[model samples]
Target: MLTSSTFSYAIGLILQSIAARRTITSNSIERGLVIRLATDRCYAWGLAAQVAGFLLAFYARETLPVYLVQAAACAAVGVAAVMGAVAFGWRVTRAEAAVLAVLTVALVLLAGAAEPSRVTAVPPATGWVLTALLASCLALAPAAWRARGAVPLAGLAGAAFAVLAVASRPLPALDVTALPLQPLAWLTLAAAAVGQILLAAALQRGSTTSAGSAMDAVTMVAASAAGLALVGDRIADGRTAWLVVGLILVVAGVLAMARVGTVVGEPIRHTDNDVADQPITQGNAR
Candidate 1:
């Protein structure tokens, strides 16, 4: 499941990146942007791949530590780099290859250190924590649409994805009928919705590597921390050193990826009348 999800995420993101690039070049109108993101054949297929990845990750989390699961999921960045090359002729630099190598080693160690926890039910405080985090993202969103803010928007979307992942921790343990009444389940939907919107916006304004790497870094770290502190996820016995070293390597790789995004063959096109301060939806779409 983990390995498959890694590829699915990579493929989905790559396709979505292509879709985003196409729309930004020729599309106009505010609401039309969102519509195109959904209706564009490439984007829709990309979304389907993401949904498959989500399902795979959802079940994988049932047996692994959240840190391990999240890290493994974010490993898609390396995959995306290679796929981008195939799909868009993006070149991976020497530095990127090194980062991908380090990232792979880190994932191996993290996987080795993960221990399946018996704790399945989410703590009551989790929902409240998710609510607070969701509110925080909403507050940060306005600033994300400003000039040169695509990375920040990606970060916020990552935070939301983290929230939803954490919120999903207890879902499999719950009775099917109880989901509708469960506040966390509802919060999960809201977080997923918000994350997708912000992520789309981020893709609209940023390079795939920059936006995706940022989102993956934030999502893995935030979700891993929340899982450890709030939800009792555990490292394997006598493997604390492995977890620590693995996390350090993960951080190093993610930071490197964020610094250098896998850009497409051509530079992003800009029209003469383009807005400088914000996205078209914000300025002229009104």
Candidate 2:
């Protein structure tokens, strides 16, 4: 029985992978088809890394509870950030590291306090879920078109993300094959992919932290609730309730740290100097 927190980290990593692919895809046109192919290759490697990490996480889960797994996932961000620095020569300053450290600690403590064994039943396939996801995408189009900032775009994308998260984790009560082939599932999937692309572009345009915050919030809440409501996840006891609280705190901590980073790393500058100025205004002050 995995808790909501566990799912949150898992989904966060999934979104992070999507964001990474978006980063590569951004230059698809300028880099040409060959670059696109290369980007796909990189995407494959990232997927592989995730798979390996998950396998390790599963093993870690055996000795530790779900919270530990979530904490471990938080730790992986530090690894990823360092990889970004070492492999690509992307510099990481003390402030960024500090923020990430605080996030890691919060997640670790949350995980330590969380309860274990909260399993949801696998949902049966249903047409309505698909329909709802499709409707969400259609609704988001105009909003996306009109979106002026990263936040709005992230919000729109978050809407689509909510659809996918809810649709993917279908209610446990339903039958798989009995369920109609959902156009909504496909649509929501497409929306999620595209939303991520838009999210990455917005992040690049301004604040990665802000974009990350939006992505994290939208995806986590959408997925967790879907798991709970439709799939039969329960917080029926003290341990489970405490675990849920820890997860929320963990999520809040990560987003808070990200927001702090956004504020400290002002003016949207990508250089060391951007963060060198201390916790000034968020992104290239207007």
Write candidate 1's Cα lDDT for 1-286 as tens digits: 8899889988888767666755553222245777878877778988889888888887787667778877877888778887767765668888888889999999999989999864557667778988999999998787676636357888998999999888877676667899899888899889988888888887776666677878888998899889888778888889999998998788678778867645443433334553233322221211
Model 2 stretches astray by more than 4 angstroms: 1-79, 109-134, 170-194, 260-286
lDDT of 1 at 188: 86
lDDT, each prediction: 0.77, 0.46
- TM-score of each model, in listed order: 0.87, 0.54
Which residue pairs in candidate 1 collide?
none
Q: Say which candidate scores most in TM-score.
A: 1
